[model samples]
Target: MSLNFKDGRSDLKRDSLMAEEQALPPSYSVQPPRQEAPEDLSARLARLDLRSSVKNGMNVSADQCTAHLKLLEAFNQLREDIGQIPGLFGIEDPIFENPETPDTHQHVQSPQALAKVRVAEKRWSVYVARAVARFEKWYSTCVPATMGGAPCNRLTGNQFCTVKGLDRVAYHGLPIKQLTLPDQLPPLDVLMVWHSYMLNPRCFFEDCFRYGKLDFFATALPWTAIDPYIDIVTFEFKPSVQAVENFETSTGLCWSNLNDGMEKTFSCPRCLSTISVPWTQGSLWTIANEMTPGNGFADGDFLAHCRVCDTKITHDYLRVLKFKADVQAFMSPSDTPLPGTLLNKDGQPGKLTVLGSPPESFFPNSLLNAGLSHRFLLLLDNPNVSMSDVRSIWEQGLTDKNLVHKAKGVRTRLLPKERLSIRRMMSRYWFNSSPFALDLAGAVIRQGSFVEKMHNIDWLHSPALKSTMERLVQKYQRFFTLMAENPGKVAVPTLDVDLAWHTHQLNPLEYYSYSDKMCYGKYIDHDDKIEETALSDAFTWTSKAYADKYGEPYSECTCWYCEAIRESHTSKLDRFFKPNKVQALEKLHGVEVPSDPLNSPHISAHNAVRDPESEAKQRVKAAELDKAYHKACAKAKKKGKPEPRRDDYFYYYAWGYPMYMPLYYPYGVPVVGGGGFYPADPCMVNTGAGSYGACAAGTCGGMAAAGGACGGGSGGCGGGCGGGGGCGGGGGCGGGGGGCGGGGGC
Candidate 1:
């Protein structure tokens, strides 16, 4: 039976217990493994309790299925590895259940069910750090400072590599051995960018078709497998010699020589003349380092004035111009097939298709939306580009009716919602691609920075780190639920939850499937650009809503107000604890006693044991207690008859007290100056207390249940009998009593 202490009541009943006992199985024989059962509809609906319509839009494939399974296997191995890390608390599957709640209530995940998610979140930082390092190494190795006779840098090189990797992932002409499988992933850098892009499945699908990377879109990256060979601590991995050689051959770039520097030479966007920029970390006024004005990539404000055309040139502007030309080709009506277009046997143009959907079906509508993005970028690049000019350029492109009319006639082939959704997603793709590419470049940079902060946190060594991570993961789930329930409303996450969310997104295929099911058929997008005031307001709303739903403070704080509240709650729970004589011994004995079962100020020993540092201290105290108890036991053994067996009532009444004391001693009562034992108070053996039954009127009939309540009691104290002066008597059968109001008894 599942126990829930949230409401301080048990689901147990005398009649139900008897019935269950009577219904026990006849033998201890093991049964055959059960077949996997389909998920209940009610459980799925409960998970999706969102504002929008629920739909299953996940595109599954053989590769994705294999990758998903492999990823799960890798995750299990990673979890076991993490568990073995020294100084971490051993894994204890804490049960969380409220059986009284309705079926529609969110079903709490079992520990095994939640294990993979936690592992993913735990290793999220490692993934980011490794991905960044991999990208850097590959960029330094294969891609140059310039590509395709155009100006390029790490930023541009990343974009080129992403497309190239997509090309490899989608290529069907390759031999079976050469195919990019779950085990054979693309270059780390390519995988990282591609992973983020896939977070928006709708956009990923259309973009894949746009570049003819249908295979790439269909096959999900085995994210857990990505870091299997890497060290979680250092977040490092060495590429195999064959893998390195493969990258060089595929890209036609040397892998050995490393080209280093920020200096970039590129053709000016307007002048069509070569311009060399000496990029530096400083801005205009910091010229002592020989830094050029308007050439500050590191400072995040790089722009150059073309002397020939007087056009303001930035890397963003250059990228926009290049992208415009690429998209414009889709509408050019050219006889030459585009990059992703399939060729016929005679080398003639075959129909452009993505997973069987004709590209012409939505080219006009999609391109028109792409124009919307292009216009936005053009205006953003240089305010001098008039809105009228952008509109005129866009209008001129639409003069061709062939692509538009053809798309209109293909209505039967495409659903209205599907076509509109594709167009909307393509528009979003354009919107994120320029200026910031928040979904692409921005995600990499932002998540990478956050991961650095996560690494600095001593996750493996710290005592509180495990619980801290658990809290963050819990909040992460709630944050997503909030977004799912609210739809378009803004919701801000605390830094901890943000880390968890970032890691969740890293496994794009799983995230996509999860969001599709949970968020009402809508992929909840993470908006990293909320205004300060708006973010603050959203956080407040989040905190209030979180408290209302979860019945706890949204975020923890060490501030005075929060501390005061914690203390208040702690004081109220103190009624459940037995009066600890360990505190009394601290005053009597000058030597320091270790913090443990009774000596520690916490109401429960479990709380003291939560921190590794605290638990280590508790161990020493426990050993000291053990030594003292055995010494007293040896002294008693000389008398024979085992000194009349110390009071069992002491164990019955003390809730959360350490029951496994040496020689059956209740508390860690210290030996004062190596004399007689400092006698503790008499045991209140009151019957009819809620938990396990206690002895009645000094009778020795009952025993306290391990990890169960001692229950509330009144004054029925009996004097101590032997050890010191008088040892308290054995316990009684305190049946059907008022249950422990606070902590569980010994």
Candidate 2:
């Protein structure tokens, strides 16, 4: 009974099925329904009135109320000032007073004005640092004790797990009852983190709405209570007694005492039984060690053992469960009944009532933050997909087509088109690459870490703080430019640049507008969960690109000795063999290197003191040099030649010997004589490494003019100019005397 396998009837049947599939509506065009996002609360924030929220049962003190108003005033002023900086927020097109014959260089302030701004900025940074320090302490220990069972609940779950959405209810998942704001303001430090978090308005709003944090979201920071200080070194931040009490009462733990021992306990995913594991303090072991397979909160292999379920809980298993849950929530039909907790407009327990659909009534967060979730759903459609397969999809890069091909149902047809259409509709959040949990966690950790790092290095308190900030601003501008140019590529920032970036994100409303207009027609979202290898690769690329575009080293040592060594072109070992050279280096720079120079402090320590007389002399000399530079550019422009390149008309810092080091360009980097995007001209490079007062070298005109005395040319170590000079790049150009100050022995 051999049947004819090549039957015409079979071919006809297959063709009919193919034709039917083709005739069906393109699934890509039919996007899943997503509710419109709520209007921005910029107006409400600008003219913030907390009377409504304050009436919600929390007792408010008269003193506290007064304090909050004052703090709010200061915060608003700071926002206004930060907003005016053109490139600080994002790339701003040159605004022209007159459309015809506009001055391309008009956007730039004079070098003197720029210097004043930088100085003011340095002062503001001190307070910012203090606020950040407090925030870190609060965030690390703010876990509530009612999370799981008694013993397991006292400690915070894995910081990484909480961040990655594994422990969904920790930070974002507080019970509905504890959602209201306390009348007293949180300590300044806690407020700082909150302030920065809110500045990322979209992220903050979505998080609150998703987690039923309506009351918290409506509350405002008590700006009036804050004491703004200029000096970071002496400024002491004291959270109000009421504020402290409120925090302690709510969390059932001491805010000051965060030590919970070496091991943290949590509940098993499968069983309700508590599981204990070794814990490290910082989130994801980022502060202690690199994330390897068996390190802190390792997302591979066994997480713990569950005795009740007789199940070995692995990271893979937890992720799978979470992913499945997330997918189900994301695919929920619009007609599904709203949760009773969410339906209560009054936000009172046991007072739920059925109401018509409203703007705030919908809970679409899973779909709103569905990038990874949607992608995972497609993979799960394949019945044959294994745990390894899921892990591979997330860990490795796969294109859209490849992802679609892996799915095994009618959903595959709908997803590709649906995702694309949905993305277009929700253009504002198109760049969000991870779950909301991961994004929130990353932003919190990075911002807190940066502020703390800045404070520890004494950058906020340094006498050379202005100069340091000036350089940071420039570097940050370049960093943002790189991000705008290269889409979908990770770019790691230096500590200085990262500080500036964080500051910009603090004002979320303005940031959104600026980013949308300037940065690729959408907001550029920050992601902290990028693989270490990818971050390294991005950093290496960033360094090279930055150097090429800006013609300066992207990374520089802030240590005095290193700067001295690099500037002088002498090795550290030179102190032993070429003792005279080392002595000259110290004398020329006016810094005393210690006997054991193994651990060096920041260069700012040596360069903090200001010499009024020396500063005046330098300013006078700088004025003369600045004129000469402009004259060179003007002469070139009139001759119909290219305006003198910014690289030309250098402000040379020369030692008594025949050494020359170009220190600054008073005018910003303009391509033509008066065109292009010009940044604020940096102040004259202060070459003195001691007291920030001594004249380290000669000026372009003469040694005496530079406030330095000419002497027998011997061992004058070079000091690289600070403003915009190519640090540690060009070779030294020597001129006349050894330097003004007499040589001191090393």
- Using TM-score, give the best candidate's number: 1
lDDT for 392 in candidate 1 is 43
Alpha carbon deviation, residue 153, candidate 2 (Å): 27
TM-score for each predicted model, relative to the true structure? 0.40, 0.37
Error of 1 at 109 (Å): 48
Cα RMSD, each candidate: 27.0, 27.0
Count of clashing residue pairs in every prediction: 17, 24
Q: For model 2, how does the per-residue alpha-carbon lDDT over 17-40 read when each residue is reduced to its tens digit?
A: 112112211111132344386433
**lDDT tens per residue, model 1, 271-315:** 689776543322221113121222333223456676787788654
Give the Å shift of residue 324 in candidate 1: 3.7
**CA lDDT of 511 in candidate 2?**
37
Worst-scoring 10-residue span by lDDT in model 1: 718-727
lDDT score at residue 109, model 1, on the 0-100 scale: 24
